[model samples]
Target: MREIELSLNQTQKIRLKRALEKLESLSSKANSNSNASVSISDSIPVNLEDGVLKGHGTLDLNGELVATVCGVVERVNKLVYVRALRARYKPEVGDIVVGRVSEVAQKRWRLDIHYSQDAVLMLSSMNLPDGIQRRRTALDELNMRSIFEENDVICAEVRGIQHDGLHLQARSQKYGKLERGQLLTVPPYLVRRRKQHFHHLEQYGVDLILGCNGFIWVGEHVEVKDDMVEDQVSKPEQQKSNKNSISLEEQEQTYTPIETRQNICRIANAVRVLSILGFNINIEVIMDTMNLSSSLNLDIHEMLGSEFCVLVAEGEAERRSLTKRKG
Candidate 1:
């Protein structure tokens, strides 16, 4: 039993991923019993292929297959209930899900997460980390949305469930605005059902929230920089000694990485063309608009780069109709 839980090596990891993928598909739709007239048992019968029904059972909590119902197996036992197969990482007591502030509600922020409405991140529920005894002032008149601004991305905890939607709390420094960097979303199904961990980019040094609803955000760890304080000192000699540090920070600026800038520019240009033309801008349009990549036949390689701007401004004036219409 102990060995069963041992870590899987890389090859084993891939194999397991493949196996889980198959299991996911197979478990989605159970096969019907061989004989049609028998009605295939009322529920999922657990008949193994070419094997006898070991007995009617349920796959129980402790991960052992156990019996829930009693009946004669017409064929192999394949009937099943409780479709909680791939329990990879469902939301639980204190999971931090990354979500964008969708809309400002009366007292809460409605986030457009793929979860079961916009999950509510209640203001009062936020971290008074030193606990209830840390109440410094009158807390009754606290407004919810004031703490969090509109469209601000927040990392929040799955405080609990109130209604069908998830309840959230963001009292800690861990749960706050995501700034500077960008976010990326993977398929919720892929993320939730990953038997293996979703690969993380170590270089980015960012916080990630894998929401049960499939929303993911990766960005610089705001409000937590270890070297930030050391970067500044009042003494001239100390400041002179850290000239390299200043240059390092400056080096980090001046230009975004090449590929990142390229992608950003390309996406911006695509949006520009799309909005300006008010039409479908194909590969041709993207290339032409960006002015970085070629529009010629073999330019497909340059078409895709991930630097997409979160927000782009609308134009001031419509391209004055260059129309001299003659049929």
Candidate 2:
């Protein structure tokens, strides 16, 4: 278990220890049924007559298959691989990821997605702000920085891995530059791949994007508006207003509400607590934790305190126990 450094009193320390032990017990019971944890150089039993195929994190030595990494062993048909509990993000096709722009090149932007190699977002792969499909010209290449400058945080889908490296695309309106959000990085393993990674908390007017690369974005919700409709509506208004004067709409876009900001912080802190506890992070779990904080009238910053961590640990243990019983 990873040690968490926090200030706590004697009573709080005792309570935290007990809660963590209970959580550990529950996790062990759950893992025992589904996975076999292995260490480095551990031999993986296999039937020679069946012809075993070793996959990633495995090495064949002296006609024996041994794990090359510390993780859980998984077998699929004749293929076997070890799933590392803590590792850098591994990109897969169609996975949603949030990454920061490392460099703005001629026709592509390089992004750091916590992977061994930086991912590439080509100009032809993404839709223009005007939502038009046309050939990218030299001018487009020249004005690339205007679209996405260096250090911009963007959300995109993994296109594929080619001879060069991993490529990403942002063809949809929902997948684009992210702004006014707190980006929180957690262990990629803690965030399992799911069907829906983008969530809008309507009640709080906040957007929660669980990036498969362990980049969690908590920001004020921005409605995906139709660019064509907006263009038609704004053309006449633009003619009426002075070109030098900023419009009310532009001002509104630049500002975020205080309540929304608070909610974003609250959600971000909940994710932090879950990451610190080494718990599986999902929308359901995050919402439950946020709701618990709200119910207890805990401040957003207080969620990081030792007392709240213990409470979360205990709650998680109970939740898992109930889930096991139901299963």
lDDT (tens digit, per residue) of candidate 1 on 1-327? 001232446655555445434433332323332321111223443334434334333433343334444322233334433322222335666665677888766556777555655788754666433334343344422434444557777666778877657788766544555554455443343343332222222333333344444455433333332233321111111122345667766857734465544354344444343332223223333333444333322242333322111111111111111111220
Distance from true position, residue 81, model 2, in Å? 1.2
Question: lDDT of all the models against the reference?
Answer: 0.42, 0.84
Query: Which run of 10 residues does model 1 get worst, by summed lDDT?
Result: 309-318
Candidate 2: tens digits of C-alpha lDDT, residues 65-157: 899999888989899999988878888999989999999986899999988999999999987866679999998898787678888788989
Best by TM-score: 2
The local lDDT score (0 to 100) that residue 314 gets in candidate 1 is 13
The residue ranges of model 2 lying beyond 4 angstroms of the native Cα positions read: 60-64, 226-244, 247-254
- lDDT (Cα, 0-100) at 96 in candidate 2: 89
Top candidate when judged by lDDT against the true structure: 2
- Worst ten in a row by lDDT for model 2: 231-240
